[model samples]
Target: MITLKDVCFQYSADSTVKALRHIDLTIQDGECVVLTGESGCGKTTLTRCLNGLVPSFYEGELTGGLLLDEKNLLEMPQYEISRHVGTVFQDPRSQFFTVDSTDEVAFGCENLSMSTEKINQNIQKAFHNLRIEALKDCSLFALSSGERQKLAVAAIYAMDTPVLVLDEPSANLDLETMEVLRGILQELKREGKTIIVSEHRLSYLMGVADRYVYIQDGEIKQIWTPRQAEELSKAERKALGLRSFQSISLADIAKEGAPAEQGKRIEGRGLAVRLDKTEVFRGLTFNFQWGPAGKVVGITGNNGSGKTTFAKMLCGLLKPSEGALLFDGKPAAAKERLRQTYFVMQDTDYQLFTESVRHELELAERKNHRPCDMELILERMGLSQAAERHPLSLSGGQKQRVTIAAAMASGSDILVLDEPTSGLDGRNMQRLKETILALKKQGKLIFVVTHDMEFLDGIYDEVMSFAQKIR
Candidate 1:
């Protein structure tokens, strides 16, 4: 259904630094194709080419031809190309320019001039097909990470495009949600939709993939069938740059069957938050205590259910609008909060403003009056190799760890991280888990807001969930 012939692309005017080179591939109807590559190895660029974004949205030199059916995608207008090929981006927030879930799903169909009734029908169909029927009425900001991901897929599927491309669909999903998505893909396959996914979670896609295409250094290194992928050994797979999976849990590491019960690290008595006339959350009081002096706390809920808001409140970045926040049974304010707390924002770029990774941690140390033994933290996070590199040039996992190291090195007694594992692989997730545990061992309180329950398992002493409060 789609083909790329002798395709080459460059992101800059230089034309020397090619993002993709001489790429040749084909995707038949109903085929489930998996694209694998290291960070910055052109997986995203190649996929962007399929939708005519290479020379359109991205400024680059393009050579050779890409054909979707009989027409060359390189020559077609981007809008025309999108009609046949739908893309779901790595970050769902990037695709959301609408308010509610239903409007978001129907937005694309409406633009295509589909009838109102037809658009509505497709919206409902998409909702039911993805098992997110209840989410149709929710605001886009109110959905969970998993729900947003499902909605993004639903929106793309509603377009009824013949070719669907997803960039790392399982990046932020917990194991259970990942399985649901895999089932959805299987159903989509049965409907004969051509699907191409760029994923680092090979374990999740292991048996589901019909074909594996590995890209390295802007070129296709190998293309293999499912059987071929299965035959490869662990070392051989790593050599092919495939990321591995871990079934080990924190329980296994601690050799404890169950986590200890949490007591009360931070207690908010009758706390409430209001924005203007609207109450975000009211009369909601909770207590977080150390299960052990060194254990993690995982806080998660439906998106916009105030996870970030609550994180900010906990870290003193946002005031409670109403109540008193207590730390260890004492009243807390900015000065006290700063001495004990540090928050890692969801987007690390928002917090990262340093030239090199080393300097980034150094700045955090200076600001917090903490020790500057950043090398030890870097080594713990497996970021020593990229210690001197520009923070922006590092991969998502590397950048996340750099932010984490900065937070840890700040010498705060409490650390609040928002979606720290959003874009990490299994190996990197394990590494991050180890780092968190190390911090926990030091009697530092770790509060994480994430959808990655695999990492949360056995780590969290308490799991706090929030639901939208009704008036």
Candidate 2:
């Protein structure tokens, strides 16, 4: 069993700010507990405490008892604590060290000095359990974000640790891949491993979680059993900034794109991209239009199906090898497209370059012919409290929103957001939708590259898919 008693932690970077406050919780040997909360509400910090990374990896002032089977986890060495707990981080890229999929899976077991044959067996078993055998022996860099997440889970699964912690494991997964993840979690729970998950997308955890622990502003707000979670009305969940309690599938989301009323149009004729001598997509003839109450088109496809590549192409980050893009019936070159488009990348770390979030938005605002409401944008994106903080110093979700606020300030006609809601809570997702709609009124054309079904509901004006395979 794992227990946290009166645990309070303040990061060394922000001495006056406590990341976690009075966190008291317990997990039985085989319980599956989910940490649910708004963005930056201390869920991730608490998970770090359980894994012995609070003071070890993150440098923080920690006070309180964190015990695993009556042994103080805070006193244990990181390597020793890792044996009992295997963690799959929010961003799978952070935890990966190997290039090959099979090798990555074997890395944890190899660290235990297990025999070569046994390690190989464990690797194979993990891949098979996750139904990711097709990903075996593939290059990690070549895989999609969701595929990399699958491999990350497989790597930890091979360890067979008593305590398993998965942070937003399904954040980037497609509809089909998410079902696969759900099955794996259910199987792991049946095997009696104590599981803790920190998530913004709660629909995927419905049947698998034994308890839902709601956290707010660095404190535990409420703890609910599965039945209680089910009993809560949709409005109640919304009031708490929680996502859906029921399961969601592709059919539950909007799949058709809405026709815009008299707006700018982007036409693509026989557009194709070739990377490393491989065609990502081809024979792509399409026209997309957006107008006031600006349309946010959600892009959905299987892992490695060229969603990000397409987003890059639309935003002028990459040029099409064949044919061209026309804006409002005029052929637009890469340079012109570059001038008209702004992209919020999937990895916010690559896009955030400012010392402070406020300064980031201010710099972007200066680029626009007209200025934006910086304070209002900050409030809508839920970054008002962290406006003066460095973009890199914020939580993953906060970083995601900061990039978006910068995009909003850029005053670009076409905006491409790749997985913007991956780390966003329901309330903030709603806020972003409102912001996008508000931008839509200014004649902005937005394309959102994502597979988040819950986020797709009641927001996006259309749904676009490159779901078919291309050589």
Candidate 3:
């Protein structure tokens, strides 16, 4: 359904450095193509070019032909080509220009001038296929990262375009939502839709993907068929930096102490936050006590249960409407807050601004003239090779990990992360868990807000549900 011939592309702002160089590729009808590469390897750039973003949204020097079925994407305006190619971006926040989930999903089709009845029908079909019917009434701002991603996918799915390009669709999903996406992809395949997914997590898509296309340095390194995929040697697997099904979790290695009983390290007292006419939560209370220092803690709750708000309150970013947050027997203030805590936001994109990963860490300026081993931390997070590259060019997973590495590098007493594992694979998840555990051993407070049960199950000392217990 899509083809690229001798494609060479470079951003107009920087004409000397090529984003995609001499790329030739083709995706046939009803095929599931998976693109694999380290961050900044031109995967996203290539996908963007397929649907006419090259010369349109992104001002870039383009030399070569891009065809969507019979129409040339290079010759058409983005609005004109969008009808034939639907795209789901890595960051849902960037993709969503609407207020609510339903509007967001229906926006694309509405632009195409579909009938209201048809739009409603497609909405129902998409909600059912994506298993997000429960989120139909939710505001886009209130959605967890995972919900936004699912909503974005459903929006594109409803378009029924001949070609669909999903760039890191699993970046913000929990396991349950990830499974929902996999099922939806399978159903689309059965219906003969052509799909191209660029992602870091491979195991989930391995069963459904027709071909695995590996891209490196703006070129296709190799393509593997399913039959030949199973025969890959250990060296080849290591070369890909992709793990086999059985491997130790990275968290286990990072942990300083084994799992132990849980109780309280800190407690929330009648926590409440109000903004204008909305009250995020009121009369909400909880307790967390420090356990053996180096164990990971997972805090979970349904959407709108005030996880991020609470985390922000804990980190002193937001003041509670009616409650007190105590750390080690003292009240937390903006000045005193920095000595005790750091928060990894749900959207890691918010924390990044430096030119490179190394600069990001250096700018953090942790005390003791000490920080986590930057090189080793980057290596464990699968970002060593991209350490010198612009953080913006990295994959969603890479960006998430860089933020994590920055947090770990901070010599603070507490680390509160909101959905740190959103874009990670099982291997990377393990590494993060291990890192948290190691911090716990050093007597640092580790607080995680997540919906990932696998990481929560064997890792967390206590599992608290915000939505259920907040009221």
Candidate 4:
């Protein structure tokens, strides 16, 4: 059993950020606890604390008691904590030290000084048990985020830790992919592994989580059973800033997307792309322009179905091996498309270069050569309070919004946001929806690559299913 007796922590003595405060809770052995709340509400921090990250890796002032199985985890060395607890970060790429998928899975066990024979056995077992043998020997770069996520899980599974803490494993996954994770978690739970998941996307955890702990401003506000969480009223959930507890669907989108093209303002002719001998999509043709549904287009696909490849083509990040792109009934070269396109990458950290949040927008505007109401953009994105804070210092969801705000500042005609709502709570999702609608009003051609059904249900004037086209 894991227990916290008035556990509290702060990043620095002078820092005003609420990392965690008076966190008191007990998680039973073999229980699957889910930590949830709005972005920056301290869900991640609590997970860090549980995994012995606070005061171990992150420089911080620690107070109160944190015990695991009646043992003092706070006093234990971070290395010792590793034997019992293994963490899968929100971005699986960050923790990965090797390129090969199989080797990455074995990386943790090797760290523990396990024998080579035992390591290989565990690796094979992990691959077989996780049903990810296809990812064996695969390069991490070649895999989709969901595939990489499974690899991350397989790594922790190989380590055989008693407690597994996953930080938003569903962030960039499609509904079908998330079900894979849910099944993995269910299997782990059956094996009596204590699990702690810090996530904003809650529907997938409907049956997986034994307890739902709601944290707000560093405090534990509510502890709910699965039934209570699942039965939460919509109005109450919205008021509490919780995402819908029910699994949302996009299966009906095919019916709505079956109509013929309305206009040919933007189009692709015989488009095909190859990334290092891997043909992603071939002979793809789409004439998606301003239709009755407006300008927002949602790209739908399962992981590894070439949705991101299409997005790269639209945003000029990847050149097509065959065919040409025409913009406004005129051929637009790659250089010209680059100028007109603004892509917010799935990993927002790659795009953030400025120190302060406000400076990030300023840098974007400088490159854009466009006049923008920087302060107003921040306000609309609900980031006014974090304007002076460093972009990297903010939460993952906040950093993503910062990038979108930068995209808005760029004044690009084509804005491509990859998995924009992956880490967002219900409130922030609504805010982004409003922002996207506002952008649509500005005549921007927005291509959103997402698996978020709720975001799709709210945002998407048209659905472009790469699942159908690529398959």
Candidate 5:
């Protein structure tokens, strides 16, 4: 069992950010508890506290009673606590220490000084349980984000800890992979393991979670049993800034309106792209019409199917091996394409260079020489309050929104956003939808590369699937 009595923490004594406050919670063995809340509402912080990453690694002031299996976790070393409680972070790339998948999975076992036979047995059991035998010899860097996520979970599984905590495990995964994750969680529950997940995506967990805990503004606001959670209406959930507990399909929510007729046209002839000796795509020919009255195009495919590579080509970040790109019935040069395109990368941190949100827009405008109302843009994106906050200080979702806001203010004709909704909740997704629609009305061409079916269905007007296999 795990218990927290009046737990509270802050990053600094003088900092205004109260990360967590007066939290009281308990979890029995075999319980699956999910933590849900708006971005920056302390869900991640609470998880850090539970895993001993809080006062141990990150500099912070802590005051709380944290007990794990009747032992005080506050007094235990981080390494000792890690043996009993394993954590899978949101970004799997950050936790990986080895080059190959098999070695990465066996790392935790080796750290615990387990015998070679036991380590090998645990590795085999973990891979079998996760159904990922094909990934055993793959290079960690070569694997896709979703594949890396599976490896992260496998590594923790090899540890065979009694308690596991995962933060946004499904954020970067496709639907099929998410189903696999759900199955794994259910199997873990049957083994009498304690599971705690901090996530914004709630639909996949509806079947596996036994309880739901909702936090707001650094305090526990609500706790619901599975039965009570199932009774929540969509409207009630929306009002509370929560995602839908019931699964929804794209066809159920797709817009019914007809696509606009007037827009700028982009044509590709015999398009082919090759990265080193590996071919990504070839013999592709298509015409895309986009503008102020254009459709939002969704690009999707399996991992390593060149969805991102194609987007990069369209934005002039990469030159196609063989192809002719025409913009508005004229051949477009790479320089011209680069001038007109704005890309919001999958990792928002790479694109955000400015200190403050407001200044980021200013820098973007200076580069494009386009006048924009920064204040109005911030207000529309629900980031007016964070205008003065450093971009790095904000939560993951907030940083993504800031990047989008910058792209919108850049006055670019073509905008490509990769995985924009990865960490967003239902409320924030709606806000992003509104922003996309507004941009479309202004005649900007928008391309979204994502695996989020719900998000694509809600906003995109056209779907362009890349089904060609890589060679």
Candidate 6:
């Protein structure tokens, strides 16, 4: 069992901002509890506390009693605590230290001085459980975000820890991969492991989670059993900024109308892209049309299916090895495409260069001489109150919103957002749809590279899918 008695924490002793406050909770052995809340509400911070990363790795000021069984967790070393708890972080890239999948999975066992034969056995079992046998020799750098996330979980699984804590494990996964994840979680539960998940996507956990805990501003606001969660209506869930409690089907969410064929077309002919001698795609031919005003186009596929590569080519960030791109009837030049296109990256941190949210949007507007109302844009993106806060200090979802606001202020005719809904809550996802629709009405062609079925269903006018092998 795990217990916290009046636990409170802050990153620095002098800093006034607190990450968690007066957190009182308990979990029985073999219970699966989910931590659900809005972005920046301390769900991640609480998970860090459970794994001994709060004060140990983060150098935070902590007060209160944290115990696992009879052992005082607050007094134990991080390495000692790792023997019982295994953590899978929100960003898989942050925890990876190996070049290949096989080595990565065996790293923890080696550190614990496990026998070579035992290490190999654990590796094989983990690979089989996650259905990633073919990825044993794959390079970690070459793997897609979703694949990397799976590998991260597999690595922790090989450790055979009694407690597992996962932070947003399904954020980067597609619909099919999400189902696979659910099966893995169910198997873990069957084995009598204590599981704690911090997630914004709640649908997949409905079947596996025994209880739900909601937090707000570093405090526990509510707790519910599975039976209670099922009783809440869709409106109530939305009002609380929580995602749906039931699974959503992509086929069910698809719009009724057939895709529009007549519009201003951006054509790609014989397109082939090669990165560092690795062919990502070849002989890809397609055309995307935007009507007189605009349209929302969704790009969907399994991870590593060249979605990001295609989006990069469209925004002129990467040049194709062989092909021709035409905007309307004219051949599109790299410089001209760069001038008219804005690409919001999947990793929002990579695209955010400004110190503050307001400054970021102001800089984008200044670049194009299209001055937008900074306050109005910030209000729309729900960053008005965080205008002066450092972009790096904001939550993952907030950073994504800031990047999108910058794109809107860029005054570009074409915008491509990569996984814009990755870390958003239900309310913010709806707000993003509204923002995209508003941009479409202003005659801007929009392309969203995403795996979010709910967001796609709500806004996309057309859907384009990529395959593993290009024909």
Q: Write the per-residue lDDT of candidate 2 for residues 1-471, one digit (tens) a residue.
A: 998999999999888788889989989998999999998899899999999888888998999999999998878988899899999999899999889988899899988788988998898899888888889888887777878888899999999999999888888888777888889889988999899999988877889999999999899999999899989998998899888877665577745657666767889999999877768889888888766656677888887788998888887788888987899999988778888888899888888888899999988776656688888889888888899998987888888999999998887878899999988888888888788778877777788888877776766777778786431
Candidate with the greatest lDDT versus the true structure? 6
Residue 80's lDDT within candidate 6 is 84
After superposition, the stretches of candidate 2 with alpha carbons farther than 4 Å from their true spots are 255-257, 291-293, 469-471
Lowest summed lDDT window (length 10), candidate 6: 462-471
TM-score of 1: 0.80
Report lDDT (Cα) of residue 148, candidate 3: 76
CA lDDT of each candidate? 0.76, 0.86, 0.75, 0.86, 0.85, 0.87
Evaluate residue 240 in candidate 1 and report its C-alpha lDDT on the 0 to 100 scale: 62
Q: Tens-digit lDDT track for model 4 on 30-49?
A: 99999999998988888889
Model 6, residue 455: distance off in Å is 1.3
Give lDDT tens digits, candidate 3, residues 243-303.
3422223343343444444643566788888755568788877666675454456676654
RMSD after Cα superposition, model 6? 2.0
Error of 6 at 111 (Å): 1.9
Report lDDT (Cα) of residue 418, candidate 6: 94
At residue 191, candidate 5 shows an lDDT of 94
Which pairs clash in the backbone of model 5? 291-443, 292-443
User: What's the true lDDT of residue 458 in model 4?
Assistant: 58
TM-score of 6: 0.95
Q: Candidates 4 and 5: which is better by TM-score?
A: 4
Write candidate 1's Cα lDDT for 362-445 as tens digits.
888876686857778888877887788788765555678888889978888789999887666545666777888888887877
TM-score of each: 0.80, 0.96, 0.81, 0.95, 0.93, 0.95
The TM-score measured for candidate 5 stands at 0.93
Instruction: Please report, as a residue range, the 10-residue window in candidate 2 with the lowest summed lDDT.
Output: 254-263
Q: List ranges where model 3 is wrong by over 4 Å.
A: 13-17, 230-236, 243-264, 269-293, 300-310, 318-325, 330-339, 354-359, 366-395, 422-441, 451-471
Report the Cα lDDT for residue 280, model 6.
Answer: 89
